[model samples]
Target: MTTTATTAKDLFLTAMDRRFAPEVGQGDLSLALAGAELLDLLGARALTLDGDRVVPGAAAALGDVLLDEASAALVRQPPYEQVEDWLWRRGRDLAAAYRRALQADGGLSARRSGRLGLGAVRVEPVDSPARERAAARLEAAEPVLGALAAAIGIGIAADTEAGQAAVPAAAALEDEPVTTVLAAVMDAVMELEAVRRRRSIEEAAFANIWRAP
Candidate 1:
């Protein structure tokens, strides 16, 4: 069976192939995948962001289970949540799910092993011409794919170099509705990151300030 990538989720999974580490916190990867999924839906006109809310667009299927599920979730839920909130809340083990899906599609291989004396699984891409082509396409900054790459880069800024390179390219794209939306999403995610960092620092300071007398 020839494995192919047709949606942003697929492309993101391909980019993540052999790159994700089990030691890394899942939250960053999950949010990054969520960001990629959102961009894919936006590129497909499946969803749109109005201010902070995610406005549902056409419900046409994208033939990718992850993208379809994300679309359905947006469609079924009210547009009361901001994109960042929705993403953080909904993002969970997204990278793992996509990797397993890719493995099932013959696009990747997985093996169980022990890491740091703990059980762990390692996944790598399978040899496939279609997979290579998809990876190349992702490497090249192509419209929706480029935007999705940028979103992932922004989402996991501290985790990977790919995200670092994606931000400028995504920001440099010509102005369009989708580009605008991508920029907004990036800003929202960044703001959330900032807030998280600040809260962590504040919590640490409080703990230190309340040390036993």
Candidate 2:
């Protein structure tokens, strides 16, 4: 299993493994993935956190297209993008983008099955070194990755007692930059939940009004 890859890629593969789980939102996953990219970049010293604002370092080709693209996408000017803002902007439809990238790279596959019946296809992870490496990290509770996966409500999370117990790796991530990204991911998830709930309530109220003739 290859250890050298984007954390977001690892997290994405792990999440898709739990694809049948309930309440896993694509938008939230996207946000978490974006945060993962930042975390990975921080680890590479490709960038650093100036408080919540991201300060870009010297450009480096990260050997991964997505990671390189993420580096290039950084706001180079003053008053650079904050963690939360970067999450929303980069997270937009990011889940699908990741899926496409992975599928193209043969990290993911679509199999037509009877589950959805007829032409239904299910996307599954290929038996690749990348997938194996990600599973190993999750299995070992690798701190940043475990924390990132959990933030998206996949694998283990702080919300679960076992997740809390399992992640000594999570505890290892005590540095300011790591904590900053993790906290921002959690906040973004909460905000996304609030948005979903608000829309649900609004739709229900609208239906009530429509029926109130």
Candidate 3:
């Protein structure tokens, strides 16, 4: 039976929520199992029954047309059965690291770390002559934007509320540009922009990686 696209989207989001939501601890085994079940349904295994024996095959028939290398790799394995569970395990491990970072700094620095990882994985390597030129253009634009943001006194505190609330405790002169309330707001905005870009990249990579098989 074919699973609805809506169902797949729900499963994907549920998996993300369980794995990444900071308030939630590492996802439990049950959550992992549920995620696996959703993948199974979508993978559309053709199961055959012979008395008490059951066999699963035709794994690719169930998914969409865009299977990223990561997702495709899962299908090629024998226990195509455990693909979702494998994904859950990897996801949980990633989440655990982010949680630890947040717990330590109470900031969103982990989000930046996540971006670096995604960019490393998703940005295709190319030797084309135009590639270097394009990269140079992008890099050149960074300072312009960074300077603009910095000029506005954007002091990106990873955990703005937590960090800002601690700022007033300092007995030193509060006249520093970075110490102003506006600086705190700009810092929060920078952190927010970083998080938004990182999340967008991650989600896009996820979709690209898991496009139908």
Candidate 4:
């Protein structure tokens, strides 16, 4: 595959904003961690020597991010390259599902293969090969998204509890543990930001590269 110089960064960003960040509640910490996982998936895909097989190491690594213990075990049993392909296909299907769900919820508007709407969201071509390749990345993201959402939910719950609690200062901080807990929250936020930056740079570079006469 001929990877354009900016594809990694560009796609990373798009995935972050259009998919990952919202799940993480738009925090920098969440984004950074998520970005790590996202980059790992993309990197694994980029390293495939055989298009037909899963790279075991890559699959295992990415699998750790996407699946819990039982699911991870199943992913590890397959040939690495094949597993990679499977994950990619799975992600693509899930991504399409996610998009459809979003449209249904009215979180997104219907559009074809270009930027549209007030937010300048670049809608991926529904049936494009690029989406096929992106599927694995999206699939891998499923777990991460769930984890991030859960973590934020926990955080929000804690905040609500803290607000409701009438306690001494020490007791309140101890019960909430916002300082320690916020670390994970922040990690999620940062991962999203990194992905966003990576995508923007990549998209701009891709345009410039392709436009050169």
Question: lDDT by residue for model 1 over 110-145, one digit each (tens)?
Answer: 676675635566666677775566555555435555
Query: How do the residues 62-119 of candidate 2 rate in per-residue lDDT, one tens digit apiece?
Result: 8888888889999999989999999999889988888898988888988886856667
| TM-score of each model, paired residue for residue | 0.64, 0.89, 0.23, 0.24
By lDDT, is 2 or 4 better? 2
Off by over 4 Å in 3: 1-8, 12-23, 26-39, 46-56, 59-71, 75-213
lDDT of 4 at 136: 39
For residue 103, model 4's alpha carbon misses the true position, in angstroms, by 15
| Ranked by TM-score, top first | 2, 1, 4, 3
The list of candidate 4 runs beyond 4 A from truth reads 1-172, 175-179
TM-score of 1: 0.64
lDDT (10s digit) by residue, model 4, range 87-147: 3334332334334433443333445433554564443324334444443333333333323
Best-first order by lDDT: 2, 1, 4, 3
The deviation in Å at residue 72 for candidate 1 is 1.0
The CA lDDT at 161 in model 2 is 54
Winner of 1 and 3 under lDDT: 1
Candidate 2 residue 168 C-alpha distance from true site, Å: 3.7
